[model samples]
Target: MATWISIEGHRRLVEIIPNEVQELWDKWEIRGLILVSLVSQLILIVLGNRRRYKPNICTRALVWSTYLLADWVAAVAMGAISSNLGEYYENNHKKFSKYYINPQLLAFWAPFFLMHLGGPDTITAYALEDNELWLRHLVGLLSQTALTLYIIIMSWKGNWLSHLTIAMLIVGIIKYAERTWSLYCGSIQHLRDSFLRTIDTSKKIEQQQESNNDGMNFWEFLANSIQKDFENEERRAGDPRNYLRAIYIFVSLFADMVLSPWDITQDRKELHDRGCFHWSTYFTLVNNELKLMYDVFYTKAFANYGIQGLISRLVTLITTIVVLASYCKLSENKEHQVVDQIITYLLLVGALLAELSSFFFAVFSRWTRHYFRLRGSATFCCILGCIIDCFFTKSRVHISMGQSSFFTIICNKSLIIKGNFFPVNKLEKLSSVSHRLTSEHVLQKVYRSLYDKSERSLQSNLSGVPGYRSLLLEKNKPIFASEVEFHRTIITWHIVTDLCYHFYDEPSYHFDPRKNSKEMSDYMFFLLVKQRQMLPVGAGLITLRDTVIEAKRVFEDINVVTQEDNLGEACRKLLERSTTIPRNEDLRMQSTSILLHACDITNELIADAGEYRLPMWDFVEELWVQIISYAGAQCRVDMHAHQLRRGPEFLSHVWLLQAHLGLLDQFQIIPH
Candidate 1:
């Protein structure tokens, strides 16, 4: 009798603990999760929308954190709710159960979890790699759908909310499935193969029609319509008026699609010939291209664009609103705690508002305007265009007269200019320098330097000619430069260029090529440190960091002017003060050697460019462009695909642009 009593006491204690925990969890769990889910969705819409405006570390971290946590919180909440519901069911079936039961309430809440699992369309996946896990998401859909259905069926055996629960469950399944399908469709290989298949089908049909047009079959009609549509697409793609269409064509080229080089050149020429649009257009176009890339890789953009998507979205919105209203009615008539009633009402209102906002954003988007062909009203189209333009057009980096690029530098990275971390007068000086450079910048300097080298190469090629027969052949073909070599060369060259500019006191090159070189060098370094995946193979942050540490160490030993006030002074001091020291230290020896090599190259360039009258700045600019182009081309398509997880980089854009312009050496196909 004593043993039996002890066992009974232990069982009661175990049961009591779970009941207490369940009661607490049931009261606060759904309310808290609903609040968090609603807030996360709002944060994503607001903060995520501003990502393009400010591409800094803080914004990126915040967005990434919110994106990850939002999904995690909602999923965890579902599991918790299901566990509590199961516990309640077992207790209610007991002969002397301690827990109070509300099967109807439990049934009503299960569908909300389904909706949470569906997630907001604004964020399907945070990065490109997330899309690659579409199969995993599909698995999640199956498991979660099964769990939700199980909960709904078990809880709503005699519940009035059963129909509403089923309705919501259907809506949730559709949304979650859409996200998974969009991910599969957006994967790079899949997207590319789709285009290839379309091209192949068109070709096959064309051949069939040519062989037997008299027998006008369904295939022939379909082929002719496809051909006609393709022609119309190409026309629109080439037109300057449709920037979005142009982006689509260029993006296809980057995807390894076989676009004619001549056609690309002609289209570019036409755009340039039509207007002075190149300067401002490139910035806007790049932004748009990145936006499209983001949409394709990160969001439910493709899934939510078509007529079918529109209809499905409409149905989802209507059903969700109707179900929410039904729940509100149930709350009003039922006897429930005031706080619980208020919380339920809040979730309903929040869901409705979120859906409404999403609908509005979609309607006003540039993609919608282009797709629906709603251009009948001139005033309406103009207004819509302006609104869409506002989303992309912020403070642009315009190289104009009397403007400060100091802010541009700051925005790109933090800085201490002229011993002042942030100051008004230094900003004024930087602006004046920027403005002067812009007004006086020359393209010929770059052209003449490259042209002279090309002419020499051509002369060497034609050795049989009277002037070239005696020319000596090169010992070997030039090796493709690695990323380390590129970085080391540019940093050393940038320093040497500074020394030359300051030592010679040549004011002419200072404003144009000198400034341009400094900016490009710094930008490349920034890319190396912050965006390593975008760079050519062999470029590592570790290598850059080690180099910088060595540089600082050498500079400290030299002690020239205490802090190396500017680029010119830093270069001058390194060459004059540091080189005078003994080459005992390995780091210092390496630094001195780099300085000497840069000087030697500069001398050779000067000798080779004799009497050509090409400004030194022009030669430097040409060399920089060649270096940039080579690096860009060396990066593979697979590398670009890998960047889906991290986000797009500026260098990738440069690579694509270079390929389009036929600047990349390997991409230079002769128009046969």
Candidate 2:
């Protein structure tokens, strides 16, 4: 009779809690949730303190950190309120049962925090490789936060958290093993290959100098040659682009090596993201992906809309707030609560099916890459293949990424591009040649702005029309002294897009056509033009619009600076270094150049209507110019922002200049 009464009270507690739970919010469990939230918030402050900013930090850090900081506090508030329900239950063991979903909500929130933890931000400028320690610590923090929340949530289901401690231990061990495998695949061997090759080239130079019996040492001799080679240098024989290419080769190679481990990661994430999108399309692809495992997928355990996975993470906060409010609304609409249940059941089934499909698809994707591509990242694909083999045959849940031989299936993940071609090893299509042909207007306008007699030099080069092979080889010769500076910015984009979006080509992104790019492309043909000269301009334009839009959207984004006070430093840099666009014509000409390059390459790639037959040098020039204009903008923005105490203040100068250039519309400035 006593136990029955206690169970009845425990059951009744669910009805009483939400209304009265706020009374005892300072209890241990509530305090624990608050501690977790506080810790998560601190992590953001610390990350910011570390100054681990990537090239595109504005979008990744500011946006993601603000969201995490705000939502984390909200999660804590929910936890505190939910924990107060313990007072209503007569049985101590069933104390927190009313708040069964609270910890689950926290788990659902944990992943978003983790996802943003080490996103796209660079720990170092002019470098592509992320520090291993940073990555490991981030992984540890993410995994621990997720596991702790999952344990608390799953505690209510069957107190399974206590037992799964063993499973967690095993997973941890396997993950460590996976990390070791990754380190090997992204070995430093490839990056050093170029350095070794360069050193050997230098060695030959040294030997030639040594055999001369000149009074100079190896260093002196090399310096002399470099100086002598620097003067009146016409047809650069060795790599004029060497210093930059050397740095870029390492940056790209290192980034590539680090990312190679992600082939397996890409496969899993690709499958997972695909599953999320699958929900949009009524889960048809997800269903087809895992139709064989319907029995495992159709389990009653997953009969809840919010599960501890990717999809739930996306919808959890808003959905939870809605449901909590609906608790009050549902009293009046009690009949409709039944409808909510049915709809939830159906949605839960869809989510479960999607997850089940993803895990399974992740399994086969590795095997397919392994058996077919034969570019083995590890043996785990084989193991995963076997596990899937057993599951299909036995009708049981044998889901595991480790069933494969290696941990790298994530690296070859699919992007969501609906293009006609299949996924290639590294998005292998180069920007085609005709793309180099900048706008005709740009060619006409260059001498009119920068120099007069220089036009004769530019026109001669423009008309020379070097063969595609010769010009392509010419690009390997030389560029500006800061080629490393240029390459770093460009490769940084490669890492993020490849790692995050799986390098999906944004075909719909509004780039100007080839005629437009021509204005910019002509700059490449100038006597001043050299190899890999366009990266700075390319990355800059890439994110300029986003920055302008963000600044407009936020009230606080407006940085108040007088000419000498706020905008002076930036104004000086723009003036001195020529980062400025003096007139709208200058911009229009450049925009035309970018369009010309874009159209030319795109046409060559598509053979779309095949109108223009741009020579090869012209083609390469267009591509370089397109990338350069965008990259140059990024490098300039970075340089400006680096000298500031506050970033917005630094960027505020860009706006001032944009106004000067008559690009106020592009910068979106409104009058006070």
Candidate 3:
């Protein structure tokens, strides 16, 4: 009897719960979905702009989730509405007057979903890969539009609400089309093709030949034109217009397009004249330019420019207003339910607010300023600039460099009692810390080094530090200068830098080259361990692991207390070990462990500084600049573009600056 009663109770629950859920879903499904869609739009408009600057993992994840959810919710709502209209039509046989819930209001909701699918103007592609899926978006546009049209046609009552839906549908299509076009235009293939079409190759060749005969080259003439256009006081360096123009000309570099000799010559001359060699000016311009490019590739900045963009905006605004007015007038008729009327009003108000917000972003956009200047609309541009200055204050780019130290990693490992049983690689990653604001002094030194090396070809520039190899050979330290593998060299130098940092007395001045070298060393190690994709393909993992194992063994033998506070003692202990290289050790065998080699380098640097009365930190600092710049120049173009979406990398800035300065192979033609 007890078992039978339990079975009967289970059966009742199974039947009752599902029926209750089904009834609830049937009543509130469409209403719940539409509300979700509205809230998503609000979230996107408020948070979309944050991703460009804030690259924290949590921030990006939140924005990414909302970006995807907004589209999915809008699409699902449309399908739900379509299903409801189909059911009503099949059951009632097109008898609109007898329906309890008006089908026309349901039709009115369909176009709002279409508008939601259009997305906010602040963001279009969440990642660089999203821009390549333009064809998928195009198909979605067609299918969703057809589905919306079918619903509207099924519920046609030839009334004010139906007419309002038509007007809204037109606006919705325009907005959706704009997003599709933005993705298409941002695709690598399309951007390259468009760029090629704009270049008059035949004319360029003719000009080149004629100028060659005149003892001046085509590049010189083009350089003069750039000066005339961009070097004026009103459009001088640091101007957004200059950055826009530079982007227009140099964006092709991102597509891996080989620039002609004339192009490189023209750009190098123009950049130099613009004082791009000044470290502050160079970084600021590059940072601003990449930020604009991010806007172009990932946002609606490209789509909402020029006469076409203006006309679309005007049409969208007019139709949205007209539809809102018509809805208010129709609400007076009492043909729709109070609940449906309220929901419709909420959607309309949301749409209007979204449109106005989009317009505001577009008007103050750098793209808009560029467009107006190009059209000679000085008055409008000036007015917009004043309005922008009044409202928005420019914020500095937050540049944080990742720092990972071998000494820190080794010293901190003792905290974990499991030791070798635990994953040391994970510990290394966790040990890495990031410092806010890369040193301006370091950047200045790097700029000076690169500018000095710009006259050399890419091969010669990256073939070891410019002038340090000969000096090392003179000191009989050839092995340090001629390390077989780049990764080995990085590990060797990083250990040497850590030893010097802890072993030596602190420098008197705050901006000493010693401090700068130490910071750069840590940053490079960070890249080697974490962001190796931005470096050349190599056995960095093997190199890092072997070096770590050797370091652990050394620490164990010495019985060093491996704690963060005892890091200096640990470094000094390592330095006290024998600095002699094994007599018969093969260079290849030496790769097994670089710790002793690093000790030798540290001694040689200190000895050289004392003997030659030269600043050892200068050589160390410049060597790091060469290593980092080589890494930047060697990084794949696609990887560089990919990092832009995440946040600006120092390496990407260096890469762009190298291209402009004719230090990369992309600038194929060497001007005489």
- TM-score per candidate, chains pooled: 0.72, 0.27, 0.86
RMSD, each candidate, Å? Answer: 9.3, 23.8, 5.9
Q: lDDT of candidate 3?
A: 0.73
Q: Where does candidate 2 stray beyond 4 Å?
A: 1-252, 255-672
Sorted on TM-score, best first, the list reads 3, 1, 2
Q: How accurate locally, in lDDT, is each candidate?
A: 0.53, 0.29, 0.73
lDDT of 3 by residue, 1-672 (tens): 011223565665323346456556766789889998999888888888776663677878878898999999999999988887787778764433333467888888888888888898888888888999999999999999999999899899898878888988998898898899899888898778765643553245444544532332222333333444644655556665555546755577877677666566756666666664456777776777788778768888767876677778878877888888877765774776777777888999999998888877777776676666555578988887777757763544445687888767676645343443445366555555665578787778777776666654433444345343443445466757766577887888888877777766555264377788888899989888877889888877666666676677677778886677677787777776645335356754754667777887787776777744237777677778877887887888888777776777787777777777777767746456
Q: Number of the top candidate by lDDT?
A: 3
lDDT per residue for candidate 1 within 1-672, as digits (tens), equals 011223565664323345556656546776677678767767776676554333355877887898887778778767866776777767665522333335555556656656665666666776667777888988988988888877777776654468877877777787778878878877766766766654555557646655644443222233344344435534433232345435544556545666455444544443434334433345446546666666666666766754556677787789879988777666454565566567566666766776676666666765555444322245655676778768744554322112222113222223333321234323222222222222223223322333343334421221122111111112121211211355565545554454555544545553476666545544454444444455665533333334333444455576633232354565555556544555456654443234444444445444555655246555555555555445555676656554533445445555555443444443344555
> Could you give me the TM-score of model 2 versus the true structure?
0.27
**Candidate 2, residues 1-672: lDDT per residue as tens digits?**
011123565665333344344434423354444444444434433343233112134644653455355345534544443333334333453655433323332332333222222221111111112222335544554555555454445434443323333333333333233323232222344334534443444446545543642333222323333333334435221222212121222222222222122222222223233333312121122212222111111111111111222243234323333433443443343433353334333322332333344333433432232222122323654565566556643332111100110001111123222322223322222111112222333333321221222223322221123222233345463321112323332232222112111111223123233332333332322211122221233443222222222222221223322122223332223223322223356544433112222212332333422433234324433444334322322333223222221111212222222211222122222223
* Candidate 1 pairs with clashing backbones: 445-618, 446-618
Best by TM-score: 3
Task: Output the worst ten-in-a-row residue range by lDDT, candidate 1.
Answer: 466-475
